[model samples]
Target chain A: MQIYLPIAEMAIPAESIFFVSLFVGCLSGLFGIGGGFLTTPFMIFMGVPPAVAVGTQPCQIAANGLSGMLAHLRKGHVDVKMGAVMLLGSSVGTVIGVFVFKLLKYLGQIDFAISMLYTILLSSIGLLMLYESVSKLLRKKQSVKLEFNQFKVNDFVATLPFKMRFPKSKLYISALLPIGVGFMSGILASILGIGGGFMIVPAMIYIIGMPGIVVAGTSLFQIVFTTSFATLMHAVTNNTVDILLAVILICGGVVGAQIGAVLSRRIKTTHARVLLAVLILSVAVRLSMQVFMMPDELFSTVVR
Target chain B: MRIFLVVLMVLLSAPVMAQSAVTVDLAQESIDITTGFNGADLKLFGVRDAPGRIAVVITGPQREMVVRRKQRIFGVWANLSGIKFDNVPVYYDFALEQVDGDEESEDVEARAALNIVLAQSGIGLEALHFETEENVGPDDLKVFQGALIRNKQAEGRFPEAAADITFMSDTFFKTSFYIPADVPTGEYQIKTYLIGKTSVKDVSTTNVRVGQVGFSAEIYGFAKENGLWYGLVCVMFAIFMGWLSDFIRRRL
Candidate 1:
């Protein structure tokens, strides 16, 4: 039996929708995952129009991001300079992302392309995180301390003219790195309707070799502007930002993030990644089912 | 002299009857019509004073009407009762035409007839009208109207006071009432009216109070206005948690 929701004209209950948001919020705060990866697809499954789901997911992200950023800031883990630089780059990249989005939307191939990319990117990232976490757990008995090193390579990325110093991060790297990272983050943020903090955090930690402690805070700082710009742009152009729905999700998400952040400290580092992997895999499976399984009704005519 | 006096008294008594017997009752004087974001309802009432004729002249902020449907052979294959508004303060003007029938006849016909009153205010507006029945086919009738009072000049008056209220769907609507950063805090009335053939019915009114701005306005004002502050506050909370975790780890 199919039901219709008066709010979104989609078939979903208020309780289930609340729970999905809550769960996504918890995971985001606890594991540094962008809940958009989960919430967007979940909304689609519930029959919300894609544009609305994409537009509203950022509000939820904003809630989660704010909570995480604050928590990290208080921990003395935020590198303000690095974050600012990255935000500057990401903001510029966001404009490009919007243009790219318009082009793709005009081409009418955005949905298929986004879906395919999401499936591939999420699964690969999920598997990699899962493998790393599991391996770390298995080797937990060994007290291994990896040395942090700053190495310069002979590539264009390494030799970029603008070399900047991050005193707090204790690194002097080309400004190009932060800009490149921001550009990538912006593209992903716009395309995925996420803050792109998940990718940004990992990139800062591994690629830039920033301390793990600073990763969440730095990424969140950048996310704030990226998502805010995206929200504003979507509101002005598509007028799809529903403040009512956003408020409800934010209410639940803010509470959930606080609890999740407290819980994050109790869990092992590897365990957080494992949980994130599980979430990604589940979302992927659900999305794949929609693609493979026969839909109850096929839209023969185009809506737009 | 006695017959003249008797005739004068009867004439005075008859004139008194004609003056006092007629009464006008506006029973549905004040009614409130509350609608969700996208849905619309008709605010209607009867005018008893006007015995033979009635006029409804609705005037307010200007509005527009756009209809989306499929035209079928039988007519339009859709329900045409509940009109949708993309924006708020929807205004209209309606009038009633008297036929050679009794009050009962007029009542039955009034159900099907409606006058489309356009917005008089030169504000950009849009509207969609439909019949108020379920499973019934479309009415096949279209009403195009604008505001009754339009500002002749191309310029807008009270630029700061003007606000845009847009309906997102059935339950959610957004109004960007620009309280200029410099505007003084006070109580303002937001009024909307429903105009019928001969009467003016105020449908809805809301009072908005703006308070003194302070620190909350600086950090949270922007957030409160644009709804970004909630997220910013959440981030602050997460950082606090992160700190608490680190503090605990250090002690352990």
Candidate 2:
């Protein structure tokens, strides 16, 4: 059936979008990623206005994040203090990202800039995760339990001023480290219309040196806020957020997220990381193709 | 059958468009754009005593439109120069009278005559023009205009060709306008043109309002005026929906 989206001023087939949103939501819940990296392109491909697609992504991401976060919190996986610190930094980053977005829009190059940045960000992060996860998967299983401080980056982060304890994550790192991480992710999230979970998950494991099990839940916790902030920015400034579209997305997303949360509990950490790495890499590759490929239609018309 | 009967009643109530024998009545007073609105197919049936062709034109509200052409810039397909056009009607649907069977003897000649007349009168899609204050060359403007029309046609805003205006008989004719879901809501003018073998004999017009209705309409309107509060509501509503879904899932 078709549903008319008010802000987008378009009618879309509800069933197809529901299934796609469900699939993306499952991946989000499974990996604790916001899933915006998938749905935004899907909507745009389906002929929904790009602005509306980018604007509506955050609302559904928040819903999916909340559903997944609740599951992880129940199992004591969330590091509330760490998530809060990162949230503070991301909030500032989001504001900056919005300003940068406006500047790009004024240059009449925002569309190209977004596509280029989106491809670059996704591919780099995907490669980083793929490398780390593939190395861990190939190693002897016992080394998976190696001490967290083995990475020199952790040593540098540990030596920074204003150390804060994250009891849930079992780490004592400088607050500045996570805040800086959150700040960068925040800026990227606002600019690229992603929740920054795919980036943050790797950062938590390598930079903050958090354990695997804790990374998903904490990243989701921060995601719930950053995406929510981005959502607000889209609604307030662009007025492109379609509530009906968001509702439909959430309807499918929550179910998938719940199923994913259940599956995550059964899978081994290394396998899950590898699966996530594969998923992220595939999307990145597809998006890069979009940036480089010649479009079938070379002309477009819009009314401001 | 019920929808047709309802259409009949609405048409009967519509005010007579011309003092002459020619009568044009729209099926509905206004097109209601509710949440479930996919698109609207409005019926336009009319009677013309004059011996001529029947054509109906529905023009929607005008707005400033930007037509962008893409080019390979530094090996990347990007939108390059754009031509800004003002007072461009967002919606323009035209339908010409369809000749029935056994009319092929002069169908080609009749169509050619109609095309020449329409071109001279500045009617139909081919003659579409918008006065622009941009510094673009005339050649560039023509290219951009073609692109704009092509894009709009692809979006179902403009039909690829004039819709069929079927003649119920020699005196009565009927046509319909398929207003797309993405059509901007505002006052629309529905014009019925009576054309002789070589010229327009008469024209009649009726105004119809197309505005958003129902629950979703309220949200669209609210978002336009109170962006901050609307964003807050959207965020909170999404969070509540998340919690509600989780609650339901646990029970299942």
- How high is each candidate's TM-score? 0.53, 0.86
Go through the candidates in order and give each one's DockQ.
Answer: 0.02, 0.57
* Candidate number with greatest DockQ: 2
Per-residue lDDT tens digits for candidate 2, residues B1-252, read 644775465346444534554567777778888888888888877778767777788899999987777788777788887878897888988988765642565667777887888876656898677878989888888888888998988988888887988776667677888888878989999878888878888888898999888876898999999988888888997788777766765775
TM-score for the first chain in candidate 2 comes to 0.82
Could you tell me which 10 consecutive residues in candidate 2 chain B have the lowest summed lDDT? B9-18
Candidate 1, superposed: residue stretches over 4 Å from native: A1-12, A140-156, A265-276, A292-302, B1-252
All candidates: interface RMSD: 13.5, 1.9
Encode model 1's per-residue lDDT on A1-304: one tens digit a residue.
Answer: 2222222323335556677777776776677676777778777776565666666666567656655566677788889899888877877776677677666655444554566566777787788777778878897543222422343233555667789999988878888788889888777766667777667866786567687677778888778667766676555454445444565566556556556667887876576677778878877776654444444322111112
Worst 10 residues of 1 chain A by lDDT: A295-304
Q: Alpha carbon lDDT of residue B178, candidate 1?
A: 24
Model 1 C-alpha lDDT per residue in residues B40-65, reported as the tens digit of each score = 22222221221222222222242332
